[model samples]
Target chain A: MEFSSKLLENAVNEMSQLPGIGKRTALRLVLHMLRQPATQTNALSQALMQMRTGIKFCKSCHNISDVDVCEICANPNRDESVICVVEDIRDVMAIENTSSFKGLYHVLGGKISPIDGIGPHDLNIVSLVEKVKLGGVKEIIFALSSTMEGDTTNFYIFKQIQDFDVATSTIARGISVGDELEYTDEITLGRSILNRVPFESSLKL
Target chain B: MEFSSKLLENAVNEMSQLPGIGKRTALRLVLHMLRQPATQTNALSQALMQMRTGIKFCKSCHNISDVDVCEICANPNRDESVICVVEDIRDVMAIENTSSFKGLYHVLGGKISPIDGIGPHDLNIVSLVEKVKLGGVKEIIFALSSTMEGDTTNFYIFKQIQDFDVATSTIARGISVGDELEYTDEITLGRSILNRVPFESSLKL
Candidate 1:
């Protein structure tokens, strides 16, 4: 789209560089910012710059943090003996929102996607293996998405840790809560059946 | 959602304040930025800040510009006698893209929306009327949206310029090009029939 001003065009160009935002959406956003007070736009830009420059990663878990170690790793109440391995910090936020898991997380940054040129070395696999070999961790749960990349990453990590004295498992896959059985996909339905639990164990309080 | 870090939360909060962006989408965007190089984030932030702080408005038409007067208004080749009044810079860009109208533009900044606490006084209507009074203008075209607020703003401007020598007109409202007649609503269809052009005019190359 032709912009009336180069400044407007420049702002739109930068805004559209973001994932999922297009030129039209960027223009709309920039126009909206223009309509608001200059301080608001300044605040937004300041926050983004500050966050990008000042952000840190947890040394142990490789998750985005403001300190050397993330809050999850620093928390004494969380189970340090257990680590839930996932793809990125988003998954960490998702699992934390559920409030169901009390264990620490190990963010792999991304799964092993050979098609995308992302190998085991590209992720935090080496540090994870080192953490497992340190010998205190009792269990390491693979909480990655149920895809080919996820499975491959899980297998790779498992092979590297098989010699160590640690238990490794993957999160169970099934129909989500509040979903109807008829609407569920065949693959998930079949897996849910094959991974069925005892009736007594299913009755969790 | 509970954020793992204060900086991440701050960035997400600021990003979500943009129009049409929600908390989840904001988090997704922030995470996407975190995955990218620090330079990309810095560039985006700097662009937004620079644009907001350095942008200028055309003194004559109130359209966004990098100069005291916009290029369109300063052009001697454009039809100075005819001014096309619009809501904002976006409308100016849209009309400019069409390459149909050769006249200059007068941006009202926004329409008269009482619900949004925006009135004629809040817009650049006074300057527009003053320009009309000072000009040797022959025609003033209203290219505002067909909403109630747009109509109200148009009528208010019309009242101010009705006594002037300039001929006042509005951009025609009708079924859009490439739109099926059957799928169109009755109001637009009826308006299209009522405002039909002559057979010869429709045959224009």
Candidate 2:
């Protein structure tokens, strides 16, 4: 816990401020940086600072971007009428990796967790409702996780846009393709059974 | 793994370069930072940059310091006649926490390891030998870990200063206090048995 140098202590303290990193881990990381060339530290700090200060969010989707508008939002080929609602940019990237969804995304930045003091007003809910109200959008798919916060946020957003003429749906909850049914949680298994689709309809995909 | 923004990717790439951090963890950390205020990122980067660029090493002992001479070396109360050789500043801090030894420390920065391409020339062995040759030091204690690399580094330094008039010794290798003999590793247990000290000597501490 005792540091020989104040500078070393400061660096370790700052590094430990990050989530999941402890003081010992911070010390190891800072020492690693010290052993490396100055340019390495320079690049790390410079890149972090640049990301924090220069990063932008798409005005339409609220996903992280380098420009005023992200490529997905700016792409004319993508369908803007069906917006997939999700937690953050990571979800956008995850959905994009599948290449199955042709619709655009609406990044909520985070779920509405009152335990963490985050509310509907703190997220990108207003902007999303604004996008829906502007009227060309038809369906809004709730693509958030299955957690309580995800469901709460989904319901909250659904309520906000319920008066407007828009179809609402949620991403299907079922056993993953390669997962064993025996290992599936009871709630998920029950939901999968209740929401079962026609076999012929499944083959169409 | 796919990044929507180049700046975000750069930050994640740079963050992942730190020891023990992988790309997924790096992305998690970078996203956590993005969720936080800009000031948090600024403070972390500023602290790291300051530590890297402004850090100094003690001229005498090679321990990290904020000044030309470190506090340990500059302390008049510390016995400069005896030097405790260690691997890094962390070792110095550990020994200091024990509050048992009053001798000055000589940090070797790292131990000799062929696998890692570290050699005696890469350490601070020359300066330590120089201190002994100047003829005021009485003893040199090797306080490195009991690993092969640690022993190699110790033996390498011992050969360099064997002709000098100073006495030499190593920190005792034994079962730690409060450790059960049955749970101790065979090698350490065997060494502890062979190097057993007198009953009276054990009572002194």
Estimated TM-score for each candidate: 0.97, 0.95
Q: Which candidate wins on TM-score?
A: 1
lDDT per residue, candidate 2, B159-188, as tens digits? 999998989999989899999989999999
DockQ score for candidate 2: 0.82
- Quick one: best DockQ, which candidate? 1
Native-contact recovery for every candidate? 0.86, 0.86
lDDT tens readout by residue for model 1, B1-205 = 8877889899999999998999999998988888899999999998998899999999988999999999999999999999999998888888898899999999999999999999889999998888889978999999999999999999999999999998999999999989999999999999999999999998873
Could you tell me how far off, in angstroms, the CA of residue A170 lies in candidate 1 after the best superposition?
A: 1.1
Q: Kindly list the per-residue Cα lDDT of model 1 for residues A68-146, writing each as its tens digit.
A: 9888899999999999999998899889888889999999999999899999999999998999888899999999999
TM-score, chain B, each candidate:
0.98, 0.97
Worst 10 residues of 1 chain B by lDDT: B196-205
lDDT of 2 at B112: 98
